[model samples]
Target: MTTRTMLQRPAFHWLAAAWPYALIGLVTLLVRSPTFGNPILDFDEQLYLLVGDRMLHGHLPYVDLWDRKPVGLFALYAAIRLLGGSGIIQYQLIATACVVIAAWFVRAIVRRHMGEIPAIVAAVAYVLMLNVLHGLGGQTAIFYNALTAFAAWCACKANDANTPGRIAALALAAMLALGLAIQIKYTVIPEGIFFGCWFVWRLFAAGERLRRLLGIAIAMVLVALAPTGLALGAYALAGHLDAFLFANFTSIFLRQPFPTQVRNDQISQVVACCMALLTTAGVGLFQLRTHAHGRVYADFPLLAGWWVSAFAGFGMLGDFYDFYFLPVVLPSVILGAFALRGERRGFTFGCLLLLWPCIFIPANYFSRHQGILQTSRMVSAISPYVSGHCLYIYDGPTILYYLTNACIPTRFAFPDHLTNPIETRALGVDPVEEERRVLASQPGAIVTASRSVVPRVAPATQALVREALVRDYVLIARTPTIDRTYYIWARRDLHPGPAPLVDPRAANPQ
Candidate 1:
């Protein structure tokens, strides 16, 4: 009945060890479940799912559906769609698993250097940080960051073991994971390079001989390239090698540079992020400098390198989207745990600081009540013409492609390629040619939104598609929403309700 007696019980010890994981899972579900089944937004999620559907039908990425992301990304979405068949919950489940695994790795890495308390706090912090900003969504970072953390853990193990067999195995594991991570998002390649440096430093620090080190290095190189090489081989076999090369490797450099104002906004967000994540950076710097002579400090360099390189690479474009920051958070949380070592009450204080965003930001940033049902009316209006025929959406939600279950006539899903010069140039796709091809196919129904919409297709792209519609189609119905007017057009031969689809803007005279 005494506290000491109770603590000594097997059941009590088991409960103590398992509660944190259970709690993390519970919290992840609570925070993410609401929008788990909601209709896809017009963001990356919808775009990815649309591409995934095409792949499910045996069409390859960039060949049938074009996006600049790595093929592994499309494969991931395909897996999600295959499992859940377009339901949002499958993606949510995958997202939750990622956070959980990332948190576990954060705790594992920290617990190696410190007490159980700091490790738990760091793990919990990792989960909390993920939920804040746009991290709650099913971003690529959400999945790959877990593997990144696992790679970090493997690196740490390699250093700790310091034996040839263990070191080689762990090194290979780390490099292979890093390769897969690279395939998920090429931006993380910088982190892999950083890891290479860390791997070399560890070998040297362990006084690895020239012969042994060279052999290990050779093995590591082969292992690292294996995933990418296999992917390339698969594409080559499928006759999409050129498409894969252009989208995954070449397109990144060709992306249009951000304009002055947009760059400034992104810079401001980066600054705010640096301020928000100052704890990780500060701790990492302090540990690397102050404990330079300590054995444990050897790991600090790797953490610092990962943080700096990942931040630089991902932020290279100055894109400040909330989810883009997720990859960099892993090293930050690990460094934070190291920073908290030996401090009294550090766990409580650290948790409070880390949980700040989770407590306040999401409620304000995300809508409390929004669902797929909001778009039901729009789907209803356009369903008839598009249900069984080809559909083209010049300025509408990509989700419409899913709801209507129609064939998309072109590789370009949204008008970003047509409107944004950088997007057009980066993808190496000619929007005009694509428009001509798509229009030549003559989709049975074409949907466009008025310019007033928050995210209408690029003006020029809209104009090109709109011009073709005017010349060949007739408007059957127009529905007005708060943000924009939705125009549904049918081919003139179809005689869709005797209305002129010819530039409703010109005819209505608003």
Candidate 2:
């Protein structure tokens, strides 16, 4: 065979098409691999995994376990557990894949109006922005961002489709993807509405009759609503519909907002980190005017609409947690790509580098992974105390529950539900009553922060837990950490001996 035959092979074609994305995935892996085997990166992912682990054991989210997060989020985690068993790396790997896939779609959108270089820059921005904004581990945004990005990419395809049937098919696919994304988290509702309207507007612009346009609009609406409708219907049939409804829908509105200080800090950090990227995106938009970029100008709304709708999602609930900003990262970066259209290769690469500045805000998000080895030391020192019954982390990391693999005594498994002062009114159950009930169950182990560490804790709940610990539990070990210390407590009634502390480097990582 001629030398050209080798390059023309089917496998070679696949490799040619895939290498760019595969390389992106590899870089993402290296950047994120440090946190892999190190669980407890954040409270949210650990709790999701714990619930997902329980789900595999035939426990349902709203019925058996309680958290205000949507059922689909747990189901995502449950799928990870099925594939990788109870190990933490499965979810982290899965979340990383989702982030990379989302970046691929981000590139796809940029490619429509820009070249491969800007598109690649956009994809890279999406991945790095996640780390800057705290998307490192298995946060919900990691999963849903991929879904929503796919949906938006589908909408972009519909924009370019010529025939009516093709447009309808692409639009329906976009709606279906958004519908599923909504189940993952309701925050996608605004984005879905915008996409749905984009399709309807496309048909209207094509001069379709009122009847046909109306039918398409209604069809898109129903398809967008279908996943959530099915979730609600399943609970209705299970006779636990009310429970699901309260936890998923009604409770979020009732919850108390975070304190003003917490709110201000998050906003300031997001702005500080986002300034460079936003400036780059703005410069790109500004340059468009002088450059006469006709093709980009024509397609600008699709990109701008997505960024507005997706970023607006973080504010929907009046909560501004770092991870909630995940959905917007892709669109922002893609818009920032407008800056790359300039001729200078050096300047384009420097623009991409601007994304890293945000990493400083999370402040040791990456560095803290080093502490994972030291922190795992507490597992051996504490797991023995919770050998049979359960472990309750009243004032510590929720990851401890997974680390110990102990039973949880309450449906409110998330520590924030009981510990945060503002959550007292939001959860359907009284926070104090639930905490007392957990204490009464007498978990085999209870973990609390050392005196110096102070996060947002409810004074009433703290007092109750502290008094109970003093009366009933003994400090078996004081586990030192990179930042602060935590106490592992065992029941005094057991007359527990000194729990030997495992060396920081001792526990084998999975």
Candidate 3:
């Protein structure tokens, strides 16, 4: 075949189109592999995985595990655990894949509006921003943000096409993708709404009749609701509908607001992140205006709308955490990529702007290496103590529960439910009663963390669990070399007798 004909072949075209960005993505993955390979276990990661373990054993979430996280999050973990066993390697691999895919879409979306260099820069910016903004280490945001990015790209692709059937198919797929994303984290709901509205507007702008537009909107809404509907249906069939509803939806409003000082810290962190990206993007946007073209102007609304939606989603709960800033990273980078439009000087400047994150994230990751090692040692040391026995972590790291493979005596995983006043009120659980009941069984190991290490426990519930631990158990081991505080307690009666020593008043009373 002639060179032109060979180059025009579909497979060749696909490879020609894909390989460069794919190469960039692979390089991105390699740069990030150190952090991904050596997983730094987060409390959230532990609880989600623990819930997955329960699900693996045929236990449901709200009914058995008692966490407010959406069903889809645990389901992802459960699937990963089933396929790869309870190791961080599979989770990290999956997370890295999600990030790469998202970065690829960021490039595809930007390339449609700008040159290849700017597009590649946008993709790299996304990878850097996500890591530096604390979006790493197996967080749910990694997966959902990728889904949203793909959805955004599909929306752009669908908008540019003239065929109704093609548009309809893309719209349906996008909505379903977003529905799945929403189930992973309700925080993504605003972005979903933004996309839905944008999709409707695109159809309407295509000059469809009002009636047809209404019909299309209804169809899209139905598609978007499908994942959640199926989830609700399954819970209903299993007779866990109330539990599912309360945990997934109702309990969020009941969560107590953070203390004013803590809330201020969270706010400052969120604001700083937003300002860092936005200020940089704003400078780029000014340059973009100076070199304005119809194409760039046309794309402005889409990028801006995405930014607003992401910002809204991040702050949806009127509270902030480090990971919450993740969704905004892509839009910020894409907007900043516009500044690379002019000449070599502009391109060089944009490269420098994006390079700043490369410096700090590696340093930060290395600094935390010590903490990761300490955590590993602690988990290893404590694992043997709870083998084949029930364990209770009284205001301690939830990761220990997962590491030990022990039976949990209570639904509350992190003691936040029993100790955080807001959490207790939100769940409407009696903390003292819950503690008394958990202690009644006299678990083989009751691990109590030092007060300094155990953050955010309510005073009353802390006292209640502590008192029960003191009365019922004897200290067996204390982690000496680990940097953090950890104490292991064995039931006092179990050492001397086969049957658990029962005190009728203590066991039966309120």
Candidate 2, superposed: residue stretches over 4 Å from native: 1-16, 287-295, 345-349, 352-355, 358-372, 451-455, 497-510
Best by TM-score: 2
- Expressed as tens digits, the lDDT of each residue in 99-169 for candidate 2 is 88998898888788778877877787777777777687887788888988888887778777667677788
Cα lDDT of model 1 by residue, 1-510, tens digit? 999999999999999888867876776677666557655432567777777767888877888888877788778878888786555667778878988888888888877776777777777777777666466667788888988898888887876776667777788888899888877877788888777767866786778888988888888878877888898999999888998898878887876666677666755664564454566547646865576655466676666777798788767555556567778778877777766745554644575547665554544134323445545666775677664568887666677787788888887786455555557577676776777788888888777766532222345555667677768778776765434566777777766456743554832211
lDDT of 3 by residue, 1-510 (tens): 899999889999899888867776786787567665353435567677778867988888888889887898899988888776556667877888888888888888878767887788778777777666666567888888788988888888776766666666778888988999988888888888888888777777777778877888899999988888999999999898999898888889988787878768887866665554576677666766665566555456667788889889888886677678888887777777776766885656576657666655634355346556655765664565566667887756676677667789888876557766667667747777887788777777776654433236666666665676657766555543233455666676655543233323222111
**TM-score per candidate:** 0.86, 0.91, 0.87
- For candidate 2, the per-residue lDDT at 171 reads 85
Rank order by TM-score, top first? 2, 3, 1
Each candidate's lDDT (Cα)? 0.71, 0.76, 0.73
Model 1 bad stretches (over 4 Å) = 1-6, 114-117, 287-295, 316-322, 338-352, 358-369, 449-459, 468-510
Kindly indicate the candidate among 1 and 3 with the higher lDDT.
Answer: 3
